[model samples]
Target chain A: MSIVVTYNKLVEFGDCDPARIVWFPNYFKWIDAASRNYFTQRGVPPWHATEREFGILGTPVVDTHAQFTNTASYGDVLSIHTRITQWRKTSFVMHYEVMRDHCSIMTCIETRVFAKHVGNTPDSSHHQIKAIPVPEFIKQLCGFSQ
Target chain B: MSIVVTYNKLVEFGDCDPARIVWFPNYFKWIDAASRNYFTQRGVPPWHATEREFGILGTPVVDTHAQFTNTASYGDVLSIHTRITQWRKTSFVMHYEVMRDHCSIMTCIETRVFAKHVGNTPDSSHHQIKAIPVPEFIKQLCGFSQ
Candidate 1:
């Protein structure tokens, strides 16, 4: 099991909809932030630095599933717990649990890939992004064991 | 089969991440809007009006799955096509296809429920929300027929 990193967020008024509950999309935004925070907490360098050294632009979500259990409104504080649950050759699965005062708000599992820019000419329309093999060093840094 | 509703969006500069692609969460935002637009295009009353007449607040997403196929950047115009694929007793499934120039960007399917406030006192702490039976009028408006 990988280490769990907690990311805290304060629900802002703008994050709510006319129904006065937190808009569901805001939960996804926080989940994405928590995803990156997991790497930052694990001493993984920022994506720009990794791009420069390893040609990894960033990890991008390819597939995601989320379940919302409890509704929360503005003025609530949420803690998103995130961790990598599985690592594949070119992708990994991340799980997140969002809680408000220990009450479960939502849970999500996402498959993400380590992406790198492909093609020689960056300006070319065919210059697309492609998933690369999971680097050993990054796996080790994130407490993954073979 | 329900009629498909198309919702258009112009990607803003702030909607992109440092990697210059549209952030994943923004996709969810558009999907949600498309969900609402589907009802509006079908001539269903807004949530506020439904709340007054039938105690229906709105449909809230309970479960969702999304797949990202391609990356999009700022200044791109996206068209999201939404429709109800399944109508359960208290919950329904909404499907969305996001496209840029007919090129698939992402697709999402979400399960949502018709929600109503469950208590008499609006200020009560236990005044929680609960799923209600799918309003027949709503189903009819959206072209669902038994």
Candidate 2:
């Protein structure tokens, strides 16, 4: 079984649109935060720290699919459940489910890559971002053994 | 031919993450705005106006899929090209392509519905949002014939 992390959020007035429902894009924002929180809760170093210790800058999403099941408004307390579903050589898949209390509000699946900085120098501003193999330490930190 | 609308945006510093690259969620934000801009440019009335005239609050996305091919940074001006690819009974599909000059940055496809307010009263805050059939006038305005 994979480890799951739940990230809680409080929907604010600004998170809604004139129609009085949470703007769809705000769901993506919360999902992204949940994605980061998943790593942090798994004892993985922050992106900046990882950049120094390892060559990884961060996990950048390459593709995403989302489905909105229910509408939520301001004052809604939502919880996002995140877990890594698959780990490939250079990419991984993350799944998220947003719940308003017990009701499922939305769901998302993202394909992300561990981005490495490649250039003439480490500090160069013109560095290229490339996908790197899933680090062994990261997989173990996330409680994956296979 | 379908009507295509191009929405231009200037990437601000705040749009980037600590990695100095455009945050993935920001692309969804811009794409949402571009979705509205597409309707506005195609002669569809704004949501507020339609709420009174046609009982439509807005088009809400039910599903979305996005692919990021390249990274973008601050100061990079992006142009989102949006168009309706299909019009169904109660839902429609919108396609968007984000481009920096001649380079393609990302692409997204969204399935959205024209949401109607349904309740005991039109002005009730507790009204339910339901999908409505695509209006004929809206189709004509968007240059769709079938």
Candidate 3:
């Protein structure tokens, strides 16, 4: 299933550089927040909660790439669109397109992995926690595949 | 000389949530750009330039920590104050504070380390490139020790 999230954003002055453009790194931050919101809105809660409940650890960024197509200033309204592109046994990927006034500002792709929660134990075996198959119930809502 | 770069920005609509708070991660992105601008203002140019011209490598983030004190919403004016906190032989630290309405909203500390640039060589030696010394000229401008 494809999930589309739209919101209007005002660029804060601190988000730009001397070149008067939104810093490249800021785009990732915006999309990350949006992704978290998207999951929460879908009743899955944050990834941190998923880890705690299932003892499955969410891997930090393994790979990330972005392409800047346009410039944004400190007061421009930006709209962000994010969708899951791929899912695997232990990993998934997401693609994001950020736009302003019908023009694409940036696009990003990110991949992440999962493992057993390594919270307190340092010598824990590196076994892959079973991937939580997309529940059929939620799949109906999200139109996602199992 | 201490150079100040001011950027005009508009808060993107996605920067705020239902509660109208600017998400936290965006603060780091702002400071990241400011720090890069700081280096450029200091004549180092972008890290990419240093890699090409001086055979110096771009530093990678080793660690980062931040404290959130206040909330900024969409369209708020935010000013970021960034400066070098410490410069060691092979590494440096930067401190950033984000402000809105003259009140601090967040503070961040980031540490990074540099190595010699090695093009297309994964195992290339970086031992030969000594740590870059802080020039006396910059010392006078920033009024800090190396």
Candidate 4:
């Protein structure tokens, strides 16, 4: 079983739109950060470590959904609670809740894949990424005893 | 009948992540700009215009979902096609399709409400926002007739 982690952030002035409320997209950014923090909390090394260990890049989001319950503004402090809800062969689902004290500001779920740079395209050397089966080592590190 | 609007954009180098792909959140940012462009193209005044005319602040997103179909990198030119697929009494849905040349890169659907500032709270003048019925004039301006 994976453990839940909390990532704290201060809403910056630039995070808000002309409406003075935090732009919705910023929530996704923070959620992505929180997702990384989840791995960090699990004692998983950063993505850079994989180039040497597993020849992997980083996970990429394939789908996401977010629902806003309350509004937030600059100068406000927010906490994002994150956890891996489910893990598939090559992809996993992350659940996140952004809160301000007792207020549940937003909730989100994302599907991300364990990706690797397969090779450069024939037309160009642009690296192509594809989902690979989750490694047993990485899974064990995240407390998934598979 | 609402006409679709296309917003052309250049993916800047700063928008890419360490993975060399455009960070996902930047897509939301462009989608937002495209949303506003839809209104601008429809001859609707900016949200600030509503302060005196209707006391409305702006649209606040209630829910949103997006799916990334392909990876995009810096120096890529993309176009977002946006349209209002449905308009309810108090909220409307915006559908966005992002394209690179002939490839469909991503798609999103957002539900948003017309918002306004209410009175200050007993503790402070902290502005409270609430949703109001979609104004008929605003709908008409978008080519949705009563």
Ranking by lDDT: 2, 1, 4, 3
DockQ-based CAPRI category assigned to the predicted complex of candidate 2: medium
| lDDT, residue B55, model 4 | 87
The per-model lDDT (C-alpha) reads 0.89, 0.90, 0.59, 0.88
Cα lDDT of model 4 by residue, B1-146, tens digit: 66799999998889988888888999999998999899889887888998778988888889999999888888789999999989998999999999999998899999999999887668752456899999887788888864
lDDT tens digits, residue span B18-136, model 2: 77789889998999899999989888888999999999999999999999998888888999999999999999999999999999999999999999866747554433588999888
Model 1 pairs whose backbones collide: none
Which sections of candidate 1 miss by over 4 Å? A119-127, B120-127
**Which digits, one per residue and each the tens of the lDDT, describe model 4 over residues A45-130?**
89999866887778899999999999898888999999888889889999999998889999999999988876786886355678
User: Per-residue CA lDDT of candidate 3, range B31-122, in tens?
Assistant: 66777666666666565666677655544444455565555667677887777778665567777777776777777677655545223356
Measured by TM-score, how close is model 4 to the native structure?
A: 0.95
- Candidate 3 residues lying further than 4 Å off, grouped into runs, are A56-59, A119-141, B1-146
Q: Looking at candidate 4, what is the lDDT of residue B39?
A: 86
lDDT of 3 by residue, A53-73 (tens): 764444333445555555677
TM-score of every candidate? 0.94, 0.94, 0.47, 0.95
The TM-score of chain B in candidate 2 is: 0.92
What class would a CAPRI assessor give candidate 1's docking?
Answer: medium
